[model samples]
Target: MEKNDLISDLLVKDDELAVDYYAFAHPAGFLDKTSVQEVATALRTFIDTKVVGNQPRRNVILVSHSLGGLVCRRAILDYLELGRSAGARIIGLLAMGAPHLGTDIARIASKFLPSHSVPDMQPWDELLQNLNRAWLQRVVNDGDPDLGLEQRGSVKCQVVFGLKDRVVPTASATAGAYLGELKAINKGHIELPKAESLHDVTYDVVKQFIRQCIEGTRTAPVRRAANVLADRARHLVLQDADSALEWTRYEEDVVTLGPLPAPEWLRCEVNSTRTGGLPSADFTICLALDGHFPDGVRIDYRFHFGRGLLTEPEYAAFGERLKNSELAPQDLDRVFGLKHLYLGVGEAPELRIHYEPHDRKYGAGFALLTYRIQPERLLGVGRTNTLHVCLWSIISRNHGWYSYRATRLVLEKLTLQLIAPFPALELGSSIWWCEPERNEDKIDNDRYSSRLEIEGPIPPGILVQWILDTESAGLSR
Candidate 1:
């Protein structure tokens, strides 16, 4: 039997209540995509009749991987539209590397490959028509926050992402504001079934999500849901340049939203200043979502924070020095070990701090800071003590010199302290520097990226300082 079949069989025959798994078939091609809702309803009916039919009161837990997550998500949507009483019965949803929002691969495949005609699309296909309309409505009305799980309060959802998954990047795995995320290290996408190391990880994540659902704490967070909705509103309104001219504020946070497609200059202004011994600043984060924020879209913001001025001689020399340094395993470990200083996201978002840049252009490259911004649907509460920041060096093949202008610019803007220095000559302080690792696969093989373990708040001073200082540099507030 195939792994999917084997797993399905194992689930169906489980003697215990908790281990029972019900399998459903998903049709292939665009027809499947079109009629997903009806299919979802049918699958739910089957589960209700065959799996749950008067079998005591065990919670229903849905576990899906890859394309399966899409089917399950549609089912959840159906369960919600069917009403709240039904929603309360769903105990948990666990999706592993599932592209619930949508996938580039799907779009690519649909365009290049002929969408096979499913049985439902053969004749007078009212159901197929309805399904096509439903899918289109889902996409067109995505900015309508009332459309998905975010609006449905009863279902508990969690997602697990493989760090090394080839098919779905770790970043693409998150879409819901309430889902809990588990980063499966060094796991591949398709080969996960054969990889023994993944089962426990999968089980552990599902177990936690199910536990939360049973306990009634796994629903998406209200604040996060609201934020997501607000973002949607921002996206919808910003599409019209005329609409964007109006100032808007949601929940007291001043929001200036606009859409800037690729290669278009993104600009914003902030009012920043030092007052009452603290730096107070307001930021206008110009997002170029352009067309990316679809329903179930999770936008993870990767931020770079460290210390440097825009190209000062002092800072340039420091960058060169960092580029020349070599890193050991210990150094590698420290960079990966740094914790988040402070996160602006909520609903128990998962955060991983690394010294080396991630898959982005800055990854493993020297920068002030870089963060893996993951947004989720479930609520997870935790704390960390270490500050995660990405450090990079400005070693260019053409520019044979260094400068501290960037560092100086930052200093002039924010009253930041020099937390640490590279090549610490003293005891126990040498763990921060890492020379560039030479590897074809590493993201920043040519650039110097180091992880710095620092202690401090996210210095409110910096944002305000940058605004105030940069106003002098050129930008207008």
Candidate 2:
């Protein structure tokens, strides 16, 4: 690949930085000349002659884009296996838009372009899997004195990926099995390494990584935090049963009303009935469905909190008390970690309550809240089809961190109550709630609506469906 403006800019900005662009010689149509090993051999030869012999003891950073990344990795392994002093000087490796775990695009492309590299880029290819395993083994055994690779200095690897990359997915680009520092840019595969402007976030991130390599700051704080969070989330999943039972008392205190039928809409109310008996603390309520909504119909939602809708002053006062209380900081920190914890309107227009513990130990009395979902948007649409709406995203955000044993669903203009039992959700699984059973009721009343209540730990996502009988309902424009 040709040297781009990003490479030129990096060299211009830093006088100490020296960049060498390596272009492998191979015909695009040739099958036998461009094996990964052959490219790696050429790279190893170049490093031995130009990099090592001339600039001894200098830190060397290998910046590879696209398929060059895999070749570079292989060259590094070859250099290390040779026990050459130059290999020890290699400090950093940055892979941009590299498909380490393979890409489906390569698999599709291979049918037309008969290339050796394309085969290696297939998912679960033996070559790619072996390379990953070797790299992982090296990472795991880094600190061991027996490993000659660590005697000089461990190679710090950072993987940069494009968020909108279609050719190489984030999972493949990041190569999670390697446990390297992963960063993403809001660009596509082709634009990631070519980023030149200072305003470009990818350029800034890559520059920082290069600077760290030069300064010998190998520890990545973001990577460490991510690893820690993953471990914590795993532990939480394992102990979910115990945690669910502990919070069941609070779940019992919550009650739902309404979802009562209204003209072209449905309204539901949820409240905590703890009164002054229990201590005050932050609480979350989530409403979810197990399906998708109708294509043309839009649902409008509104939330009301407290005895009545809380005034600005009352809301601020409640927030202040929560912030100043003794247990507020600790409880908030435990639940949210380093994430910002505050009560505010979320994306789906749900009210998030951050309640402070009152009376020093228990949380305050239950707060009343109401949610209204209006389906008047369905009117005037020519098509009448059954619509499904998945509310998992809405519920997960509003409910904070508690697991629900059951969920309730309410529908307008239907007089029926559905009770469904969902299978026990597995740890770390995103699929938790079951699909709601659809039943047609022949009730004559037009004032009644349908409601569903689920009973166990609330799952992360929920789904619900709506049967749009446009002819009977007269919804045409």
- Per TM-score, the best of the predicted structures is 2
lDDT of 2 by residue, 1-477 (tens): 243466545545555545454434433322543767777888777776776666665556787777778887777776666653644366678888888988898788778876888888788989888877666555433423345432312577888888899888888988743646888778788887775565467667667777888666323222322332233333332222322222211122121222223222222222322111112132233211211111211112112222122234744555455444433444222212111122211122322323322222212322212222222332332212222211211111111112222221222211223211111111122224543333334333332233433343343112222222222332221
Best by lDDT: 2
Question: Candidate 1 regions off by >4 Å?
Answer: 1-19, 28-34, 55-58, 86-88, 116-151, 193-199, 215-477
Cα distance off (Å), candidate 1, residue 409: 61
For all predicted structures, in order, the TM-scores are 0.35, 0.41
Candidate 1, residue 476: lDDT: 25
Compared with the true structure, all predictions reach lDDT values of 0.36, 0.45
**Per-residue lDDT over 203-294 for candidate 1, one digit per residue giving the tens place of the 0 to 100 score:** 44544555566556322222223334344333431122322222211111111111124211221211111111211111111111111221
